[model samples]
Target: MTTQKKVSRQVTLELEAGNAAMVDIGKMLGPTGVNTRQLKLDYDEATAPQRGEIVPVVVTVFEDRSYALRYKTPPTAHLIRKAVGLEKGAGRPGSQTVAKLSREQLREIAERKLPDLNTDDVEAAMRQIAGTARSMGVLVAD
Candidate 1:
């Protein structure tokens, strides 16, 4: 019996959901000559729900040019921006306030992010969310 060992490398990219172009894939993959058609199709399907949002994608490329894709949840900053109806986070995180979110909203955002968070408890997750809010100049208040 013979076993074949595969060599692979991982590349992380922030791709626009359902809108990945050949040029973008080419730039990320370099001259490796991987299959961009299949990659585009799969990426589009996986990121369908997150259209218009920049989401992180991890691509594992093998020696034979075959690759696999993994999608990561959007960052806390991104989620906070969405919740506060802001186009982007504050230019100066400190000494500048861009938006405000209530405690209830903070909990809600934390709950939505629980699955992706490192903590198991909701309160712990809420605290983490609050920290991100603070960095983004989103004051968590009443």
Candidate 2:
């Protein structure tokens, strides 16, 4: 029977989906003794569908120099910006209203982000997303 390899550490990286480069992966995981080339290939294939979004990956490095990757949903800010057709959020969010999002849009985003959110209740997740939108100066419409 094969024994399980002990986990050495975990590294978190936020990369443009389907666009992971071997150089970048090597830069981050080289010191940890993981095979960056294999990681990049797997990541690129797995995230191919989300080409334009940012996907967060958690790499669990094992003692034998092997690793496992866990993919997370895109950031809430990215989703919000995409929905509003903005390249970026307001520089002065507190004083400037950059855009507005309807409640329905808020719910849709909440649903998308539910798996990563702290609460299981969709209503609570919507509130959290609304708060994030407000921080970016995106008003939530009734």
> TM-scores of the models, in the given order?
0.84, 0.94
Model 1 alpha-carbon drift over 4 Å, by segment? 1-5
Give Cα distance to truth, residue 82, candidate 1, Å.
0.9
lDDT of 1 by residue, 24-142 (tens): 88888867678878888899898988898777888988889888787887777878888889998788988999999988889988887787888889999999999999988889996
lDDT assessment of candidate 2: 0.92
> Which pairs clash inside model 1?
none
**What TM-score should be assigned to candidate 2?**
0.94
Best by TM-score: 2
Candidate 2, residues 1-142, lDDT tens digits: the string is 9988899989889888999867778888999988788899899999999999999999999999899999998999999999989898889998999999999999999999999999999999999999999999999999
- The lDDT leader among the candidates is 2
Instruction: Quantify all predictions' global Cα lDDT against the true fold.
Output: 0.85, 0.92
Q: Which stretches of candidate 2 lie above 4 Å from their native place?
A: none
